[model samples]
Target: MRNSIKSVFAAIVLSIGLFPLAHADDALDASKLYKAGQLNEAIKKIDAVLAQRPKDAQMRFLKGIILTEQNKPAEAITIFSKLTDDYPELPEPYNNLAVLYASNGQYLKASAALEMAIRTNPTYGTAHENLGDVYAKLASQSYDKALQLDSANSTAKLKLNLVKNLIGNTTGGTNPKTNTSNPAPIASIPNTAMVATPPAKVIEPKPVTPTVTKSTAAINEKDNVLDVVESWAKAWSNQNVSKYLAFYAKDFQTPNGESRNTWSEDRRSRIEGKGKINVRIDAPNISIDSNVATVKFKQFYTSDRLSSTSRKTLVLSKQDGKWLIKQERSGN
Candidate 1:
């Protein structure tokens, strides 16, 4: 169990990147302390910084990581949970919350938090991976319960043993209860630019013939796909249900196996129900293969009574010189 927990923690650490803060020097000092294994000093430094800038998100996030390292899971959970509420657009807080929840055997809560993380950033690979582990844990619990209800059930016994072995393999055969003291190191959140250097020396200009590259076509395709995605978001935001629906291909996959007409009606209700809506996309990553393009990005959605940030993926296919959404999903 300990090994399994550590692996999950490692995934969380790798997926999160620190946002650049105005107080770079102070934050860097605290980060240095943390990496040097002086968690107490790291906490003190972070706390002092937080006192000066109580609303500093970067410092608050660092403090949460430090708390986790100190094995103060409860305190860490509080910090992360508050961050999620205050900065719903960011996914790291929710990811950390899931880690803390899992450590305490709260798999359901962990799964929910991870889902939120993925919602905020569907391309957040770590959250998706953690959710899978949480589901496995949930399955193991269900099997255990089934055996308790029917001790003579051989199938339940077999499943329970299989789950135990699977979990044991995940933890490298270590007992889950044995290594509760030492926690895994959280990955350092690097600043936007880790190091700064002097500008490169300028060189005299030279004329050269421009040449077309093979990637030019691919680049153009990506740009076209991006434009389509942006226009789709704009249509949805403006409540142009007709235009929005037109962005989908005729063969678009209906979510949850709903009929096309049923899906269209459901979408109409949700979109027209909102008094006003605003949707924005950020940091979109686009990939194209032949006539199909896959785009993933952070989607910020706000209406009269609700505001949320989620990661969304859209699979677009070039049809009649137009990019149309063939499929869409919430997370990667």
Candidate 2:
């Protein structure tokens, strides 16, 4: 008798050592915290695990479980969805997420989740029970599953009776459990297990995804003044005289504070007739507020015979859903 007791203790210890019992305790603590309404702290604890091992599916699952208990099943659903995505072979997240969907009134998604769970683990009793629950709510489906999963499941049989009474589908009280379907373990347990979802698996032959480009935002239009005089070089190289000129409003006032000045057709002819010109604009600072935008950039222009440069700021207005250059200046 003493030997048997020691042997049992040894086996229990071995199991704990083999299967990450410490992390599992953390998961359960997080669940308890969520149940006690300490959701933010629960999230922090779970996030700590994720930070340590981002790919840990089981940890992710536990986080979902905690969130679900906290009445944030939508967040739980997202976490479980990631778990299933990372480990398609795992049946747990699918079943858990189905419950999440059910709680959120997404019955169709619930049914799909159950189906995937059953497909991955037909022997999972909790999934089978939940699937029966899903089918029961679908308006006039056979209760074959509740009877099929556990021929003697009192809850299934009781629910089936209520459903039959509502639908008038009396079948002489036949016991479908006696039929020769595969025998599952008679133990009927609902899935109340705290999930530490399995780790994410590496998918093979991943398609290359293009980098997403982001538009740079400017705070208040003119942080970096542009050097427009230098832009003439590459502007000339690209043969885009009009392109460079368009950057400035046609009626831009000159540095000498004259209206309808700078980059005037008269100035263009004077520069082109004299020498080659190169220009570059750099250090642009821009900002957008409400419907207005401002931009400031440095302009540098060099020529064989003479070189000139100036800083510029352009104000833009989003009028009628279009950004149009409204005001241009070579600087104060």
lDDT of each: 0.71, 0.54
After superposition, the stretches of candidate 1 with alpha carbons farther than 4 Å from their true spots are 6-22, 169-332
Model 2 C-alpha lDDT per residue in residues 1-332, reported as the tens digit of each score: 00000000001112113245565566556555544556589789779877986865655765675566566767877888986665554667787777667555565787888877665555766667656655655533346565787788787677777866543334321111111122111122133333222224545897897554443233222222222323333455334557555555444445556554443665567545554444446566767677667767786656556666688776766655545556767764
Clashes of 2: 35
Q: Among all windows of ten consecutive residues in candidate 1, which has the lowest summed lDDT? A: 190-199
Model 2 per-residue lDDT at 115? 77
Candidate 1, 1-332: lDDT as tens digits: 52243222222223333344345677667666766768799888888877887767767777787677666878988888887765665677887787778777788888888877775666777667667767777887787788789889899779878777655433222222322234333344322101112225558799998676878877878878888887788678768899999999999998898999999999999999687686878889999988889999999998889899999999999999999999999965
Top candidate, metric TM-score: 1
Q: Name the Cα RMSD for model 2.
A: 24.7
Q: Estimate each model's TM-score.
A: 0.53, 0.37
Error of 2 at 55 (Å): 1.5
Clashing pairs counted in every model: 2, 35
